[model samples]
Target: MVVDIFIPCFIDQFYPETGFSMVKVLEKAGVTVRYNKNQTCCGQIAFNSGFWDHAKAMGEKFIRDFKDCSHVVAPSASCVGMVRNYYDEMFYNSALHNEYRTLKKNIYEITDFLVNILNVKDTGATFNHVVTWHSSCASLREYGLKDEPGILLRHVRGLKLVEMEDKETCCGFGGMFSVKNEPVSTAMAAHKVEMALKTGAEYIVSTDSSCLMHMQGYISKHNIPLKTIHIVDILASGWEL
Candidate 1:
């Protein structure tokens, strides 16, 4: 059960703990994890910004980096989604088309890999706080992840998993969208934070760190008591923060 861990650029830069926490959860479940330090971004941001030439080069490098791994797991749904769903198209008509397509079959977002591939429902996690799960737009629509997080959360000892309204709504962290439309992004994130606050949950959890980052921005600015947590952080809490 050796797995290759793909740390997205954002996670590598801002939330490295979540990546390590994911590895802890996997190892706790009796899985061996390997990280390729040479790995870099999945080129999702460049692709989304319509820089196909640059993104293709980045994607090619990404394929070369993880093409040999038996299984590729990433905590960021957006990066995993880009690699799994979009890379094929990017590689179409290119020499690396088959290589990229083959890699897609092995790439899995953390939750999807845990629930679907590993058949792991829980990581023996325990937390006393009440938490709400945020279904990031990419996780919900792109990855089609609906119940995986819920299944894992339910098994945590002494943790209450509450559902917030409009869980499917985006947290306004569509990568460049947040930067291009700051006001709208802030407004959407504010609404999302408000919903989490109404639940009286101490933490709002999501698989996507970008969404949490956006929502946390608003939460921090308004001095909200809520804390944004990645799902892996919650699951790996059984070991230690």
Candidate 2:
């Protein structure tokens, strides 16, 4: 199947490798993927921060960018959740409302696309390390993604998926919340990191880069050996590591 890929802002800038890994994984799976260079942020940052006008403009741009694609896939669940869950509300009563509805239905998170549409559990990946999954709040609660990633990870050749404590708890990376409530964000992150570390996991796998970015910062600050990995990276390992 042909699919259009959307790379969120942070992933584009901070985690470009994740995007590459996703492309590699999809291509290896016999899926034809297209990347729209004009695509930018999904307006999630502004929409989440209460900047409706900015969000609407960005959402319209996103809709226009991939209007012809039969399906639009994203590596970040948070970004996909924004388009699927908030685009309609952001464009309500606007000229682009109907367009937003059509675009929203085509958007799918990577794991969701792989597991649900492709109907495949394994991507022939191999990572010989003990790892645990971190369900980002947006991916878990907002998008209702519970088993897609787990199902895929379970089939990886040498990867062991351990259940981390409070798997559903927020990782303290609520985009604007991190800035507005630094103290609370840090406290929550500390607790989440503590729980993750206690699992004796070598790497914490998640679909959203924002959560990994936040947790990586704390992990660096605390000098913890635990590392954050994107699901795409894990899936693209190809038994090499």
Candidate 3:
């Protein structure tokens, strides 16, 4: 199946390798992958920040950018959730309503697309490490993703998928929430890191790198004995670095 990947600003800016890994995993599963250079932000940041006008503008561009795509998959759940769930506020009953609806139905988060749509659980990935899954708030509540990521992780060779305390808890990286409430955000990240460390896990794996990025900052500042890795990176691991 041919799929277009929507690389969010978080992945495109910071964890670029993870984006490449996403492509590798999809290709390994025998799916055709395409990245549209014309694609930009999904207007989530603006939308979340209460800038409806700017958000709608960006959302319109995003919708038009992938208008012809059969299926649009994104590595970050938050980005996918923004489009699938939040775009309704700006586009519903509007001029772009029909187009927005089409995009919403066609877009999907990576794990959701892999396990549910593509029916792919194994991608020949081998990551010999004890890792815990961090179910980002958006992935769980907004995207309604529960067992999809776990299904894919279980098939990875040498990867022990341990459960983290409050895996469903928010990582406090609520986009603008992190910046607006620095102390609260930091404390939340600390709590999450402590939980992941308690599992004796070497890596805290998650679908949203924004969460990973937030936790990684705290982990690095305190020199915590843990690292953050995206599931795409883990799924693309196995045979190579």
TM-score for each prediction? 0.97, 0.97, 0.98
Q: Write the per-residue lDDT of candidate 2 for residues 78-100, one digit (tens) a residue.
A: 88888888886867777877777
If ranked by lDDT, best first, what sequence of candidates would result?
Answer: 3, 1, 2
Candidate 1, residues 1-241, lDDT tens digits: the string is 8999999987899999998899899898788999998999889999999998999889989999988888999998888888878887778878887777788898999888899999999788888899998998898888778789999999998899888997788888899999999999999998898888889899999999999999988888889899999999989886553
Global lDDT of each model? 0.89, 0.89, 0.92
Candidates ranked by TM-score, best first? 3, 1, 2
Model 1 ranges off by over 4 Å: none
- Estimate the lDDT of model 1: 0.89
* Shift in Å, residue 127, candidate 1: 0.9
Q: Per-prediction RMSD in angstroms?
A: 1.2, 1.2, 1.0
Q: What is the lDDT of residue 32 in candidate 3?
A: 92
Best by lDDT: 3
**Residue 162 alpha-carbon offset, candidate 1, angstroms:** 0.8
